[model samples]
Target: MTTVADLAELVRAPAALSVPGDVVAGATAARALGPRTAALAGASVLLYWAGMAANDWADRRLDAVERPERPIPSGRVAPATAVGLAAGLTAAGLGLAAAAGGRRATAVALPLAAAIWGYDLTAKNTAAGPAVMAACRGLDVLLGATGGRVARAVPAALTVAAHTWTVTALSRREVTGADAALPLRTLAGTVLVAVAATASRQRDVTAALPVALAGWYVARYGGAQARVVAEPTAGRVRAAVGAGITGLPALQGALTARAGAGLLGLAVAAAAPLGRRLARKVSPT
Candidate 1:
């Protein structure tokens, strides 16, 4: 029988830590932070968990050969169970979005859910995989802005999408490993993402927090990618992907701070270390 721990692993529960920040950053940019923000964030987390479960279900065959210890292949969780959980979570996520932000949030969430399913079922192995995954994350950010001017959240959404692009690109190599050039290119992208996160029209003390958080994001994720550039082994590549997953909150926090929510951004950034710690046990990738 499947236990809660089996379901948690199937969903990569700890990795959900990186998700709430997307909503927070978008809400900050759109000036929509309020009680509803929490509900939207919760909705985002459910969608994220749905995606993870769907990914495992879709990859069950590949995982049997390459990663048999996974919940489905290992017999800890049945394939039907995984797929059922994914479907239920997806429905719950959409319902929650409708409740939290009415039709507006549901509009963004519908596409986000479709994109998540598409990436796992169809796009994950194609050349457009990274872009598809990135689009899902971008839409997630927009979901949080439904209560305010969504146009104001576009830049932050794009910034987070760029970061997701790099992470998705690296994730493709986590199992097969990659040539040094791939890590090199992703490292370059990470640097550009950090710069974009730190960009501001007014250079003042307000800029300091975002800059620091971005630096932290780059250091943690970039350092792992650098190691992959050195070896490009499957183990090293997996490590880099894991780093990208856990380090994402820092980038999200930086985007939130750049949008002028310093203290809340710091709270979001705090998730990075906690995610890293939990990753040791749960394996976020």
Candidate 2:
């Protein structure tokens, strides 16, 4: 029989912890935070969870061969049930977006959901995989900026997308390990992302929190990439991927702080270490 633990693993419940801050950073950057921010955050988490479920469902056959301990392959959850959950969550996420921010939010949510499904079903093994996954994350950030201030949120969205691309690229090698050069390149990209994130905001007393948080984000994520660069082993790659996923909240928090939501940004950043702690109990990847 399937227990709640099985479902939690299926959806990567701990990883979902990294998702809400995407919306918070976007909404704060767009000056769009309102009653809808909470709703959009919830919608983002639902969509993220949906993507995780869909990913397992689409990879069920492959998992049978390589990851037999997974929910579907292990017989702890039916394939059909996993797909059904993905579909249901997608619909619910779209509905929440629509209800919270009307047509604008729905517009972004539709494409976001489509990207999630596309990545799972057709793009997972393609060269386009990392880009597609990054787009999904970028759209999730934009979902919170649909309140007529989307243009203002572009920088935050792009920062999040760039960070996601590096993470996804590393994730591709989690099973087989990567060439040292690949992680070295990603490490360079991480530095550029950190520079861009910090430079985008004005330097002042108000910039202090964002700068510090962005530095923290860089240190944590960059440290993981450095490890992979040194070892280039599957275990190191997997650890880097997990760190990337869980460390995202810190990046988001930095962006949120850059947008003048320092306190709120700190609150969001707090989720990262918390997510890491939870990952020890339940795998985030």
Candidate 3:
């Protein structure tokens, strides 16, 4: 029997916690917050977990050499089992989306699922890897906008996709050290994202919370990238990747706030620190 610990490792469970906020931010930005939002969030988590499992399954051979401690390579979980889990979770995610929001949500979910598989099986090692993964996240945000205001959610989708691009680009170097320029460039990108997020809101009572959350996101995530620039070791790169993954909720929260959902944004922002704390116990990257 595969233990829950093994399953958790196989699915990168801690990182899934970062996913729901993506849908929340997107839906809020689109002004589509409805009873369906909860179901869409659940679908997002399922799809994320499915992607993680598929990634491990596809990388099992390479991981056996370079990451023998991983669940599949270490024999804690079988490759077949991981594939099955990925397929099952993908199906569940689509079903949940269909059940919650009908055909429109299912349409988005279909492409999102295809992107997850494509990234894991085909595009993961290519130059297009980061871009494809970013698309998956962007589509995830769009999935929440199935309520028909997808055009209004484009900015939020782009914002989340940009953040994901930086993280995915850096994740490729988690094992091998990266060029100092890589993290430096990503740090610069992070700054621009912060500026954009904060600038969206005028100085007002509502603006304060979003601005503060965006500041916190940049401070923590950008600090890690800066450290990687100073020392482009594999360890520092890993740390930076971890921070990017866990700190994303704050960025999402800022966007949610800009969408005029300040209380919901604050709730979303609170997940960042909690995700960071959980990461100490289970690596997000």
Candidate 4:
């Protein structure tokens, strides 16, 4: 029963900690320049949901191929309805971004929408998919940073973005058992870990270790997926889980200064079990 309704749950997928993380990261960065970041943080969540809905709508076809049971293709949700929903989400997100940072912040909203559309329509098929995916995460973070300290935060966002890119690729053919999914996921994780090791000068090891462990498990498990995706919905939700793993380090990093960070770590550490429960509850089939 993890029908198209289940796939539609993705409307809230990107809105979770990923959006919160971006808002916090952006506001923290922008605050360096002396701005009230609370308002910015609030708007970011709206934008995140909007962006995700647009992405889901754009990728309806690809999802249909990889996930025939999804809303748009499964007859549970109309394609036209999904498109209209995406448009509404986009408009709302743009308005929120505009209100949050005026023209500078609002400016990125359109690009973000374009990027989401582009990725759905074609990026996943091109070699540039990885780069574009990575860059997209970085750009979203930048949108948040516009409120406080833009320059200082860009590097960290870029760091996180690189990891995100790898996860995106991993969730693709590699994690979906696309014949070459294993090697691709391995290489992507390896490159990301290697980059982190070199850039953070071993400090990232503590965080990198868990990700490495996850990658190893991914390598071992091949492309087994979440049970919630109707028929074989694994591919659609596979990449969705990447957020929890890649975010582990930054959460750890945040722990050094804030108790909230430690709590985040706890949340991420429990993501697998939680996701399992969610998958089962949503997909009950």
Model 3, residue 151: displacement in angstroms?
0.8
Task: Name every residue pair that clashes in candidate 1.
Answer: none
Residue 127 of model 3, lDDT score:
98
User: What is candidate 3's lDDT per residue for 33-62, written digit by digit as tens?
Assistant: 989999999999999999999999999999
What does candidate 2's lDDT look like per residue over 214-240, in tens digits? 899889989999999989999999899
Which lDDT values do the candidates have, in the order given? Answer: 0.95, 0.90, 0.91, 0.51
> Candidate 2: where is the Cα deviation over 4 Å?
none
TM agreement with the true structure for every prediction: 0.99, 0.98, 0.98, 0.66
Alpha-carbon deviation at 188 in model 3, angstroms: 1.0
For candidate 1, give the lDDT of residue 283. 90
| Whole-model lDDT, model 4 | 0.51
Clashes of 1: 0
Report residue 150 deviation for candidate 3 (angstroms): 1.2
| lDDT, ranked from best to worst | 1, 3, 2, 4
Using lDDT as the measure, the top candidate is 1
> How should the candidates be ordered by TM-score, best one leading?
1, 2, 3, 4
Q: Kindly list the per-residue Cα lDDT of model 4 for residues 128-246, writing each as its tens digit.
A: 88777666666766776675557856665665576566556555643354334444454456445434422433344355543443443333222332221222344434543453343
